[model samples]
Target: MSEQALTLKQSGVRWLWVAIVIFFADIGIKLWVMDSMGYGWANRIEVLPFFNLLYVHNYGAAFSFLSDQAGWQRWLFTGIAFGVTALLIYWMSRLPAKEKWNNIAYAMIIGGAVGNVFDRVVHGFVVDYLDFFWGSYHWPAFNLADSAICIGAIMIILDGFRSKKLRTSN
Candidate 1:
């Protein structure tokens, strides 16, 4: 293959590796939490004044959106995650190798989505542990996959703004 084609292929492979790393790291952390805590809020390990490691099984989406609904939400979310991850992979494959931010963002999202999907499939719920709080207010519990997805989304938004600025400045 030509040098340019080879470079593009390499870039794609690098992004795939990033995704794999994120997926494994997320899964590893989750497994450790499950093993250590044994599942539930009863045994919380307070790490700091505002943080604690507490196990929570989220049956719904972010913040347990549809957790109260009958068991149908599990399959729905799993299907959505799979669909989104597949679309992101396709998008990443088509994106230009020079678009580093977009590529990284998509890879992170794909990795995180796949990790959560795996949990949903194997455990029937997403295992959450990380918890943050204030004197009288507490943030909803979340896991590494959620963090990755949030970071990836933020990067995508920032990249959009940067691209817009570059276009207008030209």
Candidate 2:
């Protein structure tokens, strides 16, 4: 194999640690929330004017898509998360070390995916606790895993724009 390919192979494995860390942190926080607050809105703690620590269980995809359906969504979402995690691992493995933003993005996605997958398998749903609201309007409750995934996605988009700018400048 070429030197560049070999270097990528060696260095790419190191980036997986970022995913592992995110997974552990997500799980740990979820456990803490579950233990401290139990389930439902009665235990919600208001921390700020626009923020609260509330527990919710998501049985479907983002924003509770298909949440009103029958029980099939749990397995469906779990399967999708597993598939996405595998794809992220493959993509991360192929990326060169110099692609720092891409590496971080993939790692965060992988970690978050695995974390939510664990919850689906063990609890039949994902536990969400972070709550943000503006007066009576509220954003959907989400957890650390969701936050990591969002951050990763944003980083990927920003990196794409940066890459495009660099290409045009050159």
Candidate 3:
């Protein structure tokens, strides 16, 4: 980052505090779950008819993709996270200070990425909870970091479509 980029006051980088907050919140929740809860479906705490708090570890990507494979996915996902973080930071540094939505979205992704990456490096897998289910089917267990990333990704996609609409109408 150049001097101009380093001066966060004038760029979307100012929104990094959002990322920091998300990171800590994700980590904190994972810690609480780890300390207070037991692992697996048998130990799950039913919070609602459709939801549960279950402890599990994801050694792979979203929806536990490739989880059954060998251990190499850990390094692959970790590398991808680092690359994405760097790119988002660079993009944020270039954005004007007035751009809040995209900055926030990028920051959120950064936070979630960092949080999961921290888990991967420290625990050799990501800690997961927050199970939503209906009848015999249950969604893959995930944590706060995954939620942030999904929301942020959705926001970015929505913004892209919205920007296109605005530009065409102008």
Candidate 4:
């Protein structure tokens, strides 16, 4: 009814759109990759010295951690994902108007988490395709959702450090 109320509603809508876009796009790509490549089909094509499109499936979290667990991890991760998504939505909804970057970071994390969570819920595993390697060392394989989460984390960290630096310098 009031101007301030209208503004708040619009801002909330915008953030909802952001979350939906990221979540849907991540899920769509992952589904396409799964269907086109099939599970465990590594269509390796070296994009650079360090990057490769190496397909893989992960039944657990980062670095295939917990992938070999005996039981119950699938449901555990699904529950965790749902909890994180709910928390992110609540946090993003409360973000001030000036905190657009923080909202964006949260959206990324929420969407990415949901994308992988969907896979875990439906298939009991997350599909990973992107691989990075250098000489004898290799990074963990990941997919679009993982990439989104990584970028979101970096943005949040940068925001925190930047604000801290500015406060100290002033």
Best model per lDDT: 3
Provide the lowest-lDDT 10-residue window in model 3: 1-10
- Quote the positional error of residue 59 for candidate 3 in Å: 0.6
Question: How high is the CA lDDT of each candidate model?
Answer: 0.86, 0.88, 0.93, 0.78
Alpha-carbon runs more than 4 Å astray in model 1: 1-13
Tens-digit lDDT string for candidate 2 (51-82): 99988899887898888888798899888988
Residues 1-170 of candidate 1 have per-residue lDDT tens digits of 99867765855435866788889998999899888785666789989999999888999999999988888999999999889888887787777667778888988888888899889999998999999999978899998889989999999899889989999999
Candidate 3 per-residue lDDT, tens place, 1-170, comes to 78754677798889999999999999999999999998888999989999999889999999998888888999899999999999999999989768999999999999999999999899989999999989989899999999999999999999999999999999
Clashes by residue pair, model 4 = none
What shift in Å separates residue 53 of candidate 3 from its native position after superposition?
Answer: 0.4
Ranking by TM-score: 3, 2, 1, 4
Shift of residue 170 alpha carbon in model 2, Å = 1.5
Off by over 4 Å in 4: 1-13, 38-43
For model 2, the superposed segments whose C-alpha errors exceed 4 Å read: 1-9
The whole-model C-alpha lDDT of candidate 1 against the native structure comes to: 0.86
Model 2 accuracy (lDDT, Cα): 0.88
* Best by the TM-score measure: 3
lDDT (0-100) at residue 157 of candidate 2? 96
What lDDT score goes with residue 68 in model 2?
A: 85
Per-residue error (Å), model 2, residue 122: 0.5
| Residue 105 local lDDT, model 3 | 96
Give the per-residue lDDT digits (tens) of candidate 4, residues 39-153.
4434666789988775577988978889999747888888887898788777765666567887888888877888888888887788888878889687888887888888888
Error of 3 at 57 (Å): 0.6
